[model samples]
Target: MGEWVKSSCNSPVPHNAFVAGRDVDGSRIYVGRAAFQGDVLPAKVIPNNRVAYVSHNGSEHRVQYYDVLVGQEYEWVVCGDGLVPANAISPGTTSTLERLYVGRVRHNNSLTIGKVQPSRGCILIPYCHREHSFNSYEVLVKKQRPKLWKSQSY
Candidate 1:
């Protein structure tokens, strides 16, 4: 019963907001459950209503607004239990390597607890760690874990 909109058109929908529908050219598109505060498409669009759910952070929402929101598969991966840089820490000036995934993120510029996956790997990390693409630093972390020392520079 919800209303749907198009992604390309200028609509009243929020910036991070998305619409489930075909482009004016008949091409299909997809958007993730979690949206940022912008007017750009988050992911590629797919044809057909095969997608049924959109999960952001930890909460899952039903893509029932076929007329307003476009349906897309949620494929975002979460990162967990890894040492991050001193600046990456949300707060505290401890020289020690602190846990980056502290179950919170800056939502609307405010502190809020994040909903994480259920798996041991990415389950403990916040949505911020999960990315459609991994950064160079993150890639290095996976490749040189054992050989690299705790404080070694990549």
Candidate 2:
């Protein structure tokens, strides 16, 4: 588990991770993808309140657990039970869209990063992977890397 560091607006976010923000209802919103009637829709806000990441054996990626505050960034380590199906999203029509939620699923017996999919309900996952049914994966909002200052020797 990586140590929690107070993150500022300029803090660096790891690769393949989403930049979480609060909605009007004060819930954490993750903009990802959703499966609808055999089609994967993009830019859809995940109907959940938490975000997650998979920390590899030698990974330094830290999981953000709460709203960013000065001198106090919340974070923790998470592990999967290996019970949830990788391709857990069920196809739904427009009428069933309200019941759709985002969940993470990882490939069995692999240490790769998990993929986000539209689930019947929100499945909070610490890590996950892929399945054959899913083709393209959702790419959410990412925090920009801080620019480094270059010293010029004239």
Candidate 3:
């Protein structure tokens, strides 16, 4: 397994850290548009494929857990918690993610980070019987409730 770190000016360094099943080298960042303009984007160090679906709007990006359909954009706010985009879509839309740790909440209209359980997922990485078909594998499908954003939870 491997580890990576995310350091941001708005928040503390090493805010979101995780162990990756594959080699996780943070030597370079695959940065893309922050989905917003003039917004000080948070330094992100998510796994190769995990992220919170974000919808970009007029000079802003709404980063949320809810799926962001193409051609649409929402708000431009972030929970103080770290983010993990959906790595894969299970049969029931239960997203399989990687390096999604820590919970976030809104306190007095301010983002707050909370307790988090280290998590990782991939169809190729078997947490169960290794002989199952990649698409039909149920190991990652069997996860606890994944509430995108709890009002005051983790």
Report the number of the highest-lDDT candidate. Answer: 2
Model 2 lDDT tens row, 1-154: 1122222223443233333344445544332333323432222132342333322222212243322211112121231232223333322223434322233323333222232333422232232231222333222212234689999999
56-82 per-residue lDDT for model 1 (tens digits): 334333333222232232112224443
**Model 2: CA > 4 A from native:** 1-16, 43-154
Q: For model 1, what is the error of residue 133's alpha carbon versus the real structure, in angstroms, after optimal superposition?
A: 19
Question: For each candidate, what TM-score against the reference?
Answer: 0.20, 0.21, 0.17
Ranking by TM-score: 2, 1, 3
Q: Quote the positional error of residue 101 for candidate 2 in Å.
A: 18
Segments in model 1 whose C-alpha atoms lie over 4 Å from true places:
1-46, 50-52, 56-59, 64-78, 82-154
Choose 1 or 3, whichever is better by TM-score: 1
C-alpha positional error of residue 76 in candidate 1 after TM-score superposition, expressed in Å: 9.5
Pairs in clash, predicted candidate 2: 105-129, 106-128, 106-129, 107-129, 114-128, 114-129
Is 2 or 3 the stronger prediction by lDDT? 2
lDDT to native, each model: 0.27, 0.29, 0.23
Task: List residue ranges in candidate 3 displaced over 4 A.
Answer: 1-3, 6-100, 117-154
